[model samples]
Target: MATNDNVYRLQGLSCMNCAAKFEKNIRAISTVEDAQVNFGALKLTVKGDATIAQLEKAGAFDGIKVLSENEPPPENTTPFWRKRESITTIISLFFIIAGYVLYFQLEPKSPFTIGTFALAIIIGGYDLFKVGLKNLVKLDFDMKTLMTIAIIGAAIIGEWGEGAIVVFLFALSEALESFSINKARKSIRTLINIAPRKAMIKRGNSVEELNVEDIRINDIMILKPGEKAAMDGEIIKGESSLNQATITGESIPVHKTFGDEVFAGTINQEGYLEVRVTKRVEDTTLSKIIHLVEEAQAERAPSQQFVDKFAKYYTPAIMAIALLVAILPPIVVGASWTEWIYLGLAVLVVGCPCALVISTPVAIVTAIGNAARNGILIKGGIHLEETGRLNAIAFDKTGTLTEGTPEVTDIVPTEPYSEADILSLAHAIEAYSQHPLASAIIKKAKLVEGKKVNAENFQSITGKGAKAVINGKEVYIGNSVLFEEIGSLPRESKQRISSLQAEGKTVMILGTSNEVYGIIAVADQIRKSSFSIIDQLFKLGIQKTIMLTGDNKTTAVAIGNQLGLSETRADLLPEDKLTTIKSLQQKYGKVAMVGDGVNDAPALASANVGIAMGGAGTDTALETANIALMADDLEKLPYTISLSRKALHVIKQNIAFSLGLKIIALLLVIPGWLTLWLAIIADVGATLLVVLNSMRLMRAGERSSIENNV
Candidate 1:
């Protein structure tokens, strides 16, 4: 907020419209250059120099409160019974119960009986009237203001029972609304509390337990078997498998050892670990995820924006129509004033836009929060909605659809040599270089530490291969292109190279300046889930599943055939991968690009939705992609798609249910069949129903990808 200064938690804000109202008012402050209210997450951020005092005062005007980071949450200070809305609702219930006893079990219309009903109205109506009267005085009408007028008008016409019912039902719905929403919000709190507050740090010859906030960068954290990693750090000592479900959403434990990275909340399943902290407590990936997720929940979807726009004009139009229904009938048609006026009040009560206004935000918030818990990050409401509409998704071949690690499958010599001879020389050259296939050749030859051939003049050819001087021989260990540079790739080897490529093996030429010595082939296996995931995408309505890779066409086609991909583009540079994404976009209205989020960053950026793999790049997944499937599991892609489509359907159901129910309730009024109690029931009932319908998303996404065995 203000480039970096202001972030506040909003308390007592359950209505999206009220949050918008407070936001507009805060931005109007001269000192507040910008302001945003995240209704779903209940946060307010401000720019410029607006102090906490200024924001709190402004928010208090609408019964909303702003608590800065340093301030204690309102829940800690205020008891449930002492809260204004809670206290008023409790008091209103008392009077309504007494009024019901007097009317149904005894006599009606006595002064004492009517006085009891009047007490219900006055007690229940106070909170609404406080906010509603202010709005009425300013001509800023909303649901509260509408209810306030309807209740007063009902009591004036001697319908004491209906008036009490309006207050009691309205207050009941408000309580339920708060309860249901807080239930949805508990997911974020649960995630925030995952990491232990204190951690065991390794000091000189001893270990000391300290609060996470007290831990500093470069601190050595000691994690024993079965202990969670204390902070985001590099593993300086020990080896273990880590269950990173909290960050990566993968249930399988990832092996971690010397020089490997570990996150603050991941579990060390075995062995001992000494980690050197790389990030401060607040800057850990988990903390950043929590903050960005909260912010993402605040963004509005297209349907949400549409509802807000519709509510702006719909409320005033309803009021005008209700006025004409009351006064115009008596003036023009000579209809009974009493009956028409009652009908007008019924229209006002039913016409409150509470249900319609809340339809989308609640569902979107619930769905997004649930997705986060399950290892998929739906960044914003817009992305959540867009993901629902994706018809095609392009996958990066290496890390996305296949195991990125390639292994030596074959070693062949050209002339007067055995496989071992070719491997010995190839491993000699590969040992001195860092290439994707270097370890494959070295491991095939069983060349261990202190047993490798010494070499010098090492140079790596990016994307093609590498070269080195091995045992006084200039050996080229790379693809055919490296041999072509030497003015010769023997014609006899072309057939063998073609055969290897056709089998999806990356063929590397082993030769010198004089003649070709040997050839080595490496192949990375396809992931076990790739075939089923591709099939599932089609089952989930994906029109096309394509692969983009820099591998040669023969190898790409070979892998593509095994996986049954709809299409494949091979032998392409990074730029070529990006252009193919554009072509897919032109072919499909909306397509998703899935990659590792590093090398594929350009194509991932260009697609309609970008999904990254692994637990790496938490911030990139946040800032770069619309969605992220943790652990790089292609199975999560279908689950992500299913969740998005489910959320979309739920949102549409809510909007239609809210508006359709209201229209039917209003139509009953034309026949003079709608009563004050019935009108309020329809209005408040829809609000609670809308809220409950949205809350279903909270648990609907609870299915674990691990338990599902995907």
Candidate 2:
């Protein structure tokens, strides 16, 4: 059975009482199956099969804000004034029309003249005045403040109609700009709203409906058909198909059975499953995603920080310039006060920092959204900016460039044994051993249905191999060192081992008491996409691509050459890998490191930007990576790098465009050629244009498609 649900990442939320109050209103929705709130992470996880439209309608409840809805914003944030921007535009236009009508019809000496001007000021300047007063107290000297100053200044000089028209147009443009920026940030908020709130807990034979936060570890929860799983857990019983699109951005539903891991917020489809909770509600994958997203949003990119710091001084300096333009010109040239003040008002309007303040954030937000849609989660805008500047890329070879799983490829036997017999005997002797190489041999043996032998005395040698008395004969399965210790070694077997090792294969010696039985060659396979990724990186002007692995020199060189890597280092321990990365960083200035799992976590974290291959369920890789690929597809790395570069390019373009327009507008304002309305147009219009341009990153899929054709 399913229940009502409501979910949100509530900031600074504390106590179960707050959770209860939040749940009380959410549960009122008839379709809500369950509601849960985690005070620790300050997130509310809710689940129900209700459509997004239903949840949006339910979100209208008091004190409850749905950060996202089925439909996109202005419906999402749904501010009071935005729903009426068109109406406000019409009303402002009415005042403009009225002022023009009075200017043409009324005589200058008429008593109704004052009323007309007063009506113009009241109609056009009310909202501007309100905003100006609020900002004035906060000392936020923005374009709105400048517009307010210019409008009142115009009124003081008896240009009432000009003042009204200027404030009205400026307010309208500001509203539009605000609306567009909010729309640009819509994707980030949508990503944050993915986690569900309620879970179905199986309490004994009966199922009890509970909030996700109340879910304890090991509690068996039933994920109903078509609903999202509300917590991170293992499926202990039953079967189901799940759509993990929200979490991984994948479109297909993955089939799940007993002992399979299921993530929170993944859609359950086609069947029901009893999932035992493996993680606390606060520690679920969805919570981690939400936490990362929030951190990304709160963190500013380097370019953004630069712009912000620049504006802190830039705005006040512009104000000071406006002051000098007002007094210095009139004093030096003996110009009339009206003429210089008009120049000053123009300066103030032109000095507004709207474009400068908005340039970088818009690009950063767009890039982040673009990355997320492609199954790459960039932790913050800073990481995106840094990634775009990567001069070198270091790769962890084991799981990054090669499939870490090594398999037995070729087997050569000596003297009496055939290849099949050698493999069977080696598998038999090593069956009692638990080493990884031993398991690989055993698995290969099982593939051909090799007979299992009941060995008499099994002796395992530390750091070497295993020996056993099989069918009244002694057998040894180990490396060359073990065979040497036992006694005789054949020249042909040694030659075969050398040839295989030269070809980048691990040669394990299989022997009996005093004779060499065979040589089994095991090798790690290169990832199909690694070669293409290297070429793409080189094409993108990346200086070098290097491989670091714990494998021996032969294996590393072979894999590196096959993948076209510029350099390769082998026989490196974990600390050695760190030293190598640090040395490369010192030479290259900035580097990116990619790896598949946790063993490379330190190197991934130490690099300029850490990219982790996440599809393989490497928790450490996912947790430590600055950029995480949700799919095993390594081709996405090139796309991610391209996207970051494009985003950085767009940010530069925006910053240039904004600053260039501001300079030109400021120069024009000093000469009285630019008016308050024109300044507002330049300020808000440039901001809107840049914001729209930045949002083009969201269409990266289209770009990728075109690139694929090329």
What lDDT does the true structure give each of the candidates? 0.81, 0.73
lDDT of 1: 0.81
Off by over 4 Å in 1: 1-5, 61-63, 70-98, 105-107, 197-214, 224-230, 269-271, 411-422, 447-494, 509-519, 615-618, 704-710
Global Cα RMSD, each model: 3.8, 8.6
In model 1, where is the ten-residue run with the lowest total lDDT?
A: 701-710
Model 1 residue pairs with clashes:
2-47
Per-residue alpha-carbon lDDT of model 2 for 1-710, expressed as tens digits? 74554445442222222334455556666766676543222345568754445543443322233443222223244573755554665676776776677677886434465456566566656766775665677675655566778877877876666676676666565565555555555566665556666777888888888977688999988877888888888898889888887677667788989999898878888887888999987777766665666557556789988987898799789889888888986799887888778778777876777777767866776667656755778888899989889899998887678777788999887778787788788877787888888878887888775555677688998988788987888888777788878776677777888888887888888777678878898888788878888998887768999999998998788778878888999999888888899999999988998887577878888889989986424467557898888776677788888888888888898898888887888878545787666766677667767767776776775546423422
Clash number by candidate, in order: 1, 14
